[model samples]
Target: MAVEAPFWFTSLAGLGAVYLSVVFLRLLPYLVLYLRQPKDLRRCYGSWAVITGPTTGLGRSMAMELARLGFNLVLLDLHPDNLREVSDTIREAHSVQTKTVVFDLSLVGTEKGDEAMRRLREAVEGVDVGMLVNNAAVAKPGALYFHEADVERLVTMIRVNAMALTEVTAAVLPGMVKRGRGAIVNVGSGSTVAVPSFPLYTVYSSSKRYVEQLSSSLYVEYKSKGIDVQLQVPFYVHTNMLSSAVKERMLLPAFVATADDYTRAAVRWIGHGPIAVPVAGQQLQWFLAAVVPEFAHNWYRLRKHLQHRAILWNLN
Candidate 1:
């Protein structure tokens, strides 16, 4: 015969089981989504997709992927030469048509910016813009205290990362609403969603927090209207955006993904949810990071940023 556990021990065991059940239930849907085949994006959304900052990194990769899948593209970036290069490359490789728009996102609220916005509005006027990838962003070159940071650069980061994303979304959402369907994929940082405090990278993470809240709200508001607003949060992508030293340190395949690899996963999750951690490994990393206490997350991030600073400045 087996001995029965004490009353407190039995109660504790029951609670632990209940907690685990809740977590499993929460994660079940995302697991299903990750395993499922991708939606026919052209059928579900529209024919043409607009990608901002489409000249480099994930934005460029996303543009190419969509074009490969037979979606016409409207590419927007600050440089005409780079835009022309990408447009030519896509035209040469894919049968899809391309439109290049040179718009400076940092000039979102200025006089020249007003004219540029008007032009951008005109550029997409007749196109069935089924998707908008708000992929442009800026971050500090190094980890530094808020007060120690360059004020001008921080302001530009806010303008490009947050303000411009908002403006571009505003520009594209109306058409989607009128057409009765569309998708907006806002590139977001895991720093905002995966941790309690980002410490030295405060501004970038905070701006992404805004993107997170906005995307979730839009998803709720537009789901019935046939619009899917998704925030794709990535942990660490091996892109030019990251320093060579940091990339070297993050050489683990599971921890850091290439831009193309991450974008391919990102495309699979569109229209399925308001938020997605596309890379399966990053999903697990996010879960473990979230399980840690807030104090520990904050302390660890601060220490890591400090070490990064030491490496960059040769202080070590």
Candidate 2:
């Protein structure tokens, strides 16, 4: 004769089933998004794209990818020679037009910044600029207490990461609004999104948090105007921006994505969502963080920073 299961066992099994179903439902949309075809960026947004800090890292890869997809580029950077080189390379490889704008992001909000903005405005004034990628940013070479950080460096970091992003977006958005269609992609950080507190890198994380908030508000404000504003948060992309020492010891190699890998995943999500963690693996990381307690996150992050600080000390 068959026997019925115990009451507690049946209840526990039912709870397990419900939890698994919730997890699956939460993940199903992202699974579908990953499998679907990428949008026609040029056709959906515009004929031309403007990218800041286009000479390296995520900027360089994104410029190349967008050019491959047939968008003419306006490349902006502080280094004139580097800008010219990237422009020439994209032109030669993709058979697409490229305009190099040598503008220092640090100059934004200064008198010289006014002149720089004027030049940037003039560069894209008559063109069909369908998208703007604000990818340029700066961070301290290593983690340190906020009190130990250089005041000048902190100001510069804020200017480059926060002010410059704002100014560049302002320079690009009015035109996009006039045209009534465009995409604005602000490259953000996983430090801000994935953790409760980024202890030693306080200013950097705080600046990125600003990016996240601004992007969200802009997305809502401009959605009715046919503009798509998205904040693309990436975690541990292996690029020149990361020092060799930290790259080697601080984070596991398995967790780090190459710039190309990140950008390819990044491009696919453009114009689709306001906030996106482009890599699927990073999305999983975000989910795991969500379930963990805030205190646990803070404690773990603090330990990581202390380890990072020790590595920096040895190098010095």
Candidate 3:
């Protein structure tokens, strides 16, 4: 005997097929990209990469990584001695060219900022800059509410975190567009996503959201022009930049990573854009955030912050 399925049952089966198809279609390319090794991004973008804030932490690490990738560097930072050291190290290790530009990003929009930019342009003039890592940013002293933060501190954070990124991108992107090749890796915060509320880092959180937005929109605008723009949302690295909470949890795999380890993973994923967390632990944290309830995540984050505050500053 032949049996016929009900109309609703057939419809449900069709819908299920469509859903699976959509999911597979959306995920396949990213999976393929992830599985395959990326092309030499430095060769594709240009021969030189200008890294801001390369004196220490993420900046220094990325600069070193790029040097290994055979790209000459124009390293910008506030410290002259560190800049010279990084340059010497890169040259000694890789035989690639290096230029050090001691510039203060916070001084943007002033006479000093203009002078700095002029010097920066001169430093990069003869080189073909291929990659731009906007990794330099200023974090608040510790967890503090908006009202509790000093106005100058808040303003400096905005200048370094937001304004500097915009200005630096503008400085280099035009050449990339004209040359028909380039890649930008703007380091972003997981605070805006993994811990969205981020109770005490109000301004810093907002500034990171701005970076995410800027990277995302610009990616859309320039992807057709052979430019790769990506925002990397890394959770934590055991650098001098770590806040008290992360510093306390430095031994935990999920909480902190050394700059060298983090940078190696991050540099490999450079063109894997528009966002990625190369550290497996941080990547897992991102996954859990997606499936977890908002209120629950908020409570968990708040608890960690409050506990760290008590330990570090004796705040209740």
RMSD of 1: 2.3
- Where is model 1 more than 4 Å wrong at Cα? 1-27, 250-253
Clashes of each: 0, 0, 1
State model 1's lDDT. 0.87
In candidate 2, position 277 carries an lDDT of: 88
Top lDDT: which candidate number? 2
lDDT of 2 by residue, 1-316 (tens): 9999999999999998987787777677678877898799999999999999999999999999999999999998999999989999999999999988888888888998888888899999989999999999998755888888888889989999999999889889998999999999999999888888899888999999999999999999999999999999999998876678888877787778889999998998898879998888888778768878999999999998888888888888
Better of 1 and 2 by lDDT: 2
Q: What lDDT does model 2 reach?
A: 0.90
- Best to worst by lDDT, what's the order? 2, 1, 3
For model 3, residues 77-162, the per-residue Cα lDDT tens digits are: 98899889989999999999988898899999989999998898787665677889999999856666667779898898999999
Candidate 3 residues lying further than 4 Å off, grouped into runs, are: 1-35, 243-246, 249-251, 314-316
Give the TM-score (vs. native) of candidate 2: 0.95
| TM values, all candidates | 0.92, 0.95, 0.86
> RMSD per prediction, one decimal?
2.3, 1.6, 4.4
- Over the stretch 1-316, how does candidate 1's per-residue lDDT look in tens digits? 9999999999999999986786676567668876777689999999999999898999999999999999999998999999999999998899899998888988989987788788789878978999999999987566778887888888889899889999888988999999999999999999998998888788888888999999999999999999999999988997776678866763465688888999988888888789998887788777768679999988889998877766667732
Q: Which residue pairs clash in candidate 2? A: none
Which order, best to worst by TM-score? 2, 1, 3
